[model samples]
Target: MGIIRTTVITGLLGTSSAAAYLAARNPVISPLAANDPIWASKVFKKHNPSRNPVTQDVCIKRIPFSKIRPELLQNDGPLALEFCRGVWSGWGFAVQRRYLDFKWRGPETSQHLWTNEQLADSTYEKGTAITDHFEVVDKTPSAITVRCGDSPRNQALRPSDGLFEISATIDRQREEVELRLKSCLFSSQGKMDGVKGPMPSWMEELHQWYARIWAETGSWRLLK
Candidate 1:
């Protein structure tokens, strides 16, 4: 029993010392570590590609102009200038128009809300324009909803026929912003041929835009 115990203790110490030596030699093991079975497994797990790469349609909407506070709109020129500045500074894009038209009260006394920023014309000019319109869908003192689209743009560029929508809502109560994007890709030339996938890159870009907008407006905390 004494000899067996001595052997076990020696074995454990040997294993511990070997492990420490190995760890010291390779202090950091990246995901691509060639000798690491765990790293190899992780890399292999991410190698997923499909012949039928899913595509999504494009769309965008905004909150209504009417629901925005009058104070927010009190100085249209300065407000627009500020918003435009934010848009350009945040996204590195320029716009031709400062404000979007909003029809209310039988369209006679309608109002206009400035866009946070417009996409650079060069970005969409080459594509077939699908739809480009803005409308006020809702109004309230605390909140507003507006919807806009570039279906014409999509229609021109889409390889096949499909529907895409992108809309955003500003929550005055929570001071939060949410964007909803839906895309449907279809083979315009064929039947029963389509796929759907999330637009992670686009979503990431939108988030950056939001952050830039907040920074430009000096309202970073307003959307908390």
Candidate 2:
């Protein structure tokens, strides 16, 4: 397969045409952070090995309190999780990865398909799966941490895994709630253990750009 086609297939997450419309409507979804925060360093260490380097990217947005429902004001965590869910669900359904979604949700799991309101109201326990590949590994009042591994390929390349986190902080003083999306990607064990793949510079750049677009789109979806 061609590099672009292969890159899309191997992409960390899928995006929708709707996201493009969202981006065009609100070109500046959030303020882009130059680098990941200090707290992210500890999170990366816990999931990945010290030998393998991890790339981190973060996008931040603060929603005004007036925009949020009065009932949701009690806790920032739930709202954060809601935004996280919106992001996950949008990405999954866009690519129509229903088989993967069903396989991960399992027959016992109720609400295989979650609506925006459902995502906002539901509580995600540890091990809960969203977007097929993303599993909630950690959940706290303020943040939700999910992990996903790329599908195996026929080539001798090391499998890649992405650790994504969504965090919400209520700023009563500022009268706005802040939501952050942090993504960390690393190569997992395979033929290229401890060595990064020789991905073309263009592909790497494209992936990063794609991720940013997804983040912006996801973040914006929470408001609508």
Please provide, for model 2 over 1-224, each residue's C-alpha lDDT reduced to its tens digit, 9 standing for 90 to 100: 13443344345335666445434432332223535353345545555544364455555666788776666567876677766766655552344344554444554445433344555455777766553455676778888887755431211223567577778778999998777666666664533343343344565545445544455545655563
- Best-fitting candidate, scored by lDDT: 2
| Tens digits of lDDT, candidate 1, 17-110 | 5435423321221112235232233211221112123333222223344534444444333333333233322322112122122212223322
Model 2 misplaced regions, further than 4 Å: 1-43, 91-93, 96-122, 151-158, 190-201, 208-224
Which 10 successive residues of model 2 have the least lDDT summed? 150-159
C-alpha-based local distance difference test score of model 1: 0.29
Overall lDDT per candidate, in order of appearance: 0.29, 0.56
Candidate 1 to native Cα RMSD, angstroms: 22.7
Clashes of each: 17, 0
- Residue 9, candidate 2: alpha-carbon lDDT: 35
